[model samples]
Target: MTNRFFNFNRAAPDARSDVSFTRRLVSDCVVTVGVLALFGLIAWILPAIDAPVGPEGIPSTVSTDPSNLPYYALRSVFRMAIALFISLIFTFVYGLAAARSRRLGKILIPLLDILQSVPILGFLSATVTIWLALFPGSMMGVEAASIFAIFTSQAWNMTFAFYRSLQSEPKELDEAVRNLRLSHWQRFWVLDVPNSMIPLLWNMMMSVGGGWFFLTASEMISVNNRTYALPGIGSYVEAAAAEQQPDKIGWAILTMVIVVVAIDILVWKPLTAWAEKFRITQSESTEPKRSAVLTLIRQSHIDDLLARILRPLGQFLDWITRPLGRTGSKWGAKPSRRRAGDIVFAAIIGILVIAGTAELMISIARTTGLAELGTAFGLGSITFLRVALLTALCSIVWVPVGAIIGMNPKVSRLIQPLVQVLASFPANFIFPFVVMVFVLWNISINWGSILLMALGTQWYILFNVIAGASAIPDDLVEMTRNFHITGWMKWKTLILPAVFGSWVTGGITAAGGAWNASIVSEIVSYGHHTLVAKGLGSYIAEATAHAEGMKTIIGVTVMAIFVVAVNYLFWNPLERLAARRFNIA
Candidate 1:
């Protein structure tokens, strides 16, 4: 009887295992097919989703109406997803490049600074004409432009997260990876990318919010009286703004708040928690930290399942990343030679790009008179000057205020979300109101344009300062407190220096954003009246609207040149200065 009972129990193990395998296989198939089918359907229908109509038979923007709020919300979700995709690509590439070499880092950091500083308006001003021309007389062009606009709102923060995380990775950890002999691809996919996730996720959340702020301006593009409105929540709010419908605005705001709360609760909180759990305590000296999501995951069956799966996945990753691991390159003494080859290749590529652009511009100018190109370039320079002055002034005003807000954690938390909302608030959302206010108050168009340009990029400084202030070492804070440091002296001696790096980073990015904003800032459209400031943005905006082949091409070319040059001359030097003075790494 005992033998029979033992045999029966032992037999159950093999029998039960087969059933579990079948169940898992079915579950995996269902999940895979479901995901694939859903995505496939979305892809099939996306192109046809334009200019939806209401029950009244009037074609609404992008086939969405206020009455059909769910559809509008879905459109916004789709747009944000696209932005996230682009951001992830750029962030990963930029982050890896920055991590590899200090020289590349130097060039990239400044480049990103300029890119981030330019406003959404500026980006639209430069690109819209080309997009319209590229996809003329079709809804496709409008959709493409919308995607590009979303890219601007999302990419920078992710890049910042990746770059900063890579830069701040512990030295010993890097050494350990080197000892592992991982390949470059392996190292990046396994070590660098995983390490970047926490910060990247946080930045992505912020980017989604930022995209919301700019979505309206992105969807509603007007250049030189030519308007191309795409269907999205941005357009909905924009239309409401035009009509001054306070009720619709209120509804939009309420909806936005709910969406933000839902995202925080359902998505970001859960993902952040899961990532935190994987972050093992590598040091006993480190203070204890609690993650609610981690706690939940720890007690769940899902965690057990994931742990089981990860054992093999981890081994696979280690094998793949072996080439990039610290000792991997040292198998032979040719790494230095290989690195030299990389440098040479990069230099050659850089030269080729410069030569190509120069040749292309010179050819265009030769065919169409250098005088015409020069005239546009000259006007662009004037616009550039205006942008610089405005950026400087705004920086002066906001940097101090940002410092104050940064120093106080409680104040920073309160102001941070508000700043984000204001920063993301679409330029068009306020353009109508600003126009009316300006007309009545007799404000000059220049000032109005400056305000628009300043509005979009100011958050860079505010957020950077806050980040820096918040990151001030706890020991340092205690020291200051013990020493009775207070007042302006405290700010000058402690807070200012502490946040200086963030300020520079933010300033560089803000400066770029301001330049972009200038395009929109320089050009304004009301019911019938359109004001064009005599600068680079207007120059591009006008060229973009004409869609007459040469004007558009020339305008884009000249604008890129000026933008690149401005960064090289101004932002690059400042970035080097900041890094030298403040880089803890």
Candidate 2:
């Protein structure tokens, strides 16, 4: 029976292998050619679909007509492509940094949370000045800013997914990597990236919708109504909204839904299917090969060509990293040496701060009085207050619910995607309705703004809580159950403490988001009537509109300081506590 199974020499080729290589190659080539041809056809036809057939002929540009499906479709495709490329690069960098070193990861991971918390509008306003400065006397400035805006919406979720995967890689998997003696690059390319794809794909799907939430800001360039519209879906949507054209708006919404579904079917589903095949455990399969794509790529002539080109580059990188490898032991390096590196990093940071401060001083002297900085700082403090208060409130509301849901795998399964959808939904889309409701109810615009900011930040806590709750050691849970622990007592004694680490992670992320969200929270919109609340976001928005460099820079600086200080003061201590209390010994 063994001989029969092992008779590879006499056995016929597998069913799929029966096809001649030439035929297989031709089929694959045809598929590839067909896909490219379809892409080209779509690209060519997309613009024409919405071409406005006026009295004379087709209009040069899209008008306020959602029936111009081609134009919006083209814009959607371009924007999606641009966003994906930017997100992929960000994920690679963030994921690599987080996985490479524990200390660096600690800072980078929390920083990611802070970055994600930042409102799309705030990001737009903050980056516009820099891009404009960089490409002075160019149309590319706004374009760059637009790309950056999309990046802000997409990068965080992907980064988070990659970081989480890196951090929580299975112990058995880790052992295999060590036993294999795989290089860092090999480990990342072969193991980490592949494992992260499932989560990353889901997150990318979520980002598509998240990207829409910020599309208005991303496409319709408006800083204090100094509007510049991109020839994109967002710009089209904004035009429709401005004209109160429900038909156009409806069309835009439908386009978005179609795009979302198309992505799910074509990209996400296929990638997820591929991910499943790669999830084989040690006991499940003895094969060294990974996924079909990876296997094919490995054997491809293109891969061979790339390997030949990259071999030298790989050697150079190894040579550079080789020196660093000798600095200390693998795990237990000298404290003094580690301290030296820390000091060097701190010194570099201090130098940058001092240099920046000096530059700011000179700029202040040239442009305005020193008093302006003080005024900006004071205004920014109000924004910080709002952010901190709102974040605390968000934690209170969402953390417990997240914990409960996280503990129940069934509930988590049902609601995780829903939570992600809610979290990613642009608060700006609802801003119009919120403004209207508040006006009708005679509620303050400040309260309305607060809610908008909270919308993005609140979900961070929930996600963290859920993750934390789910991560609680099964042994601990079983012990608790064995002892008949239940109700509030169960939560107090077991659940909270067990999931405390996750809570800290979530809180940190939420707080960071709140601070960023405040930039949007402090500014309110009610049609033609604009309400500027007493906060930093309002200040920054005002500064950005007028292109007030001093105030904007000062406001961003103040905001960063407040965020960093709060994290250091509150979150760091809590993180230490959680680690100490919940270390997986």
The Cα local distance difference test for each model comes to: 0.62, 0.63
Among the numbered candidates, top lDDT falls to 2
lDDT of 2 by residue, 368-411 (tens): 67887788778777777777778779877887898777666566
RMSD of 2: 7.9
Pairs clashing in candidate 2? Answer: 50-68, 117-513
- Give per-residue lDDT, candidate 2, residue 224: 43
After superposing candidate 1 on the true structure, give the runs of residues whose Cα lies further than 4 Å from its correct spot: 1-65, 101-145, 168-173, 176-206, 221-229, 240-254, 257-315, 324-328, 331-347, 366-368, 397-409
Q: Write the per-residue lDDT of candidate 1 for residues 207-266, one digit (tens) a residue.
A: 775677577777777654456676566777777765656567556655666555555544
Residue-level lDDT for 3 in candidate 1:
19
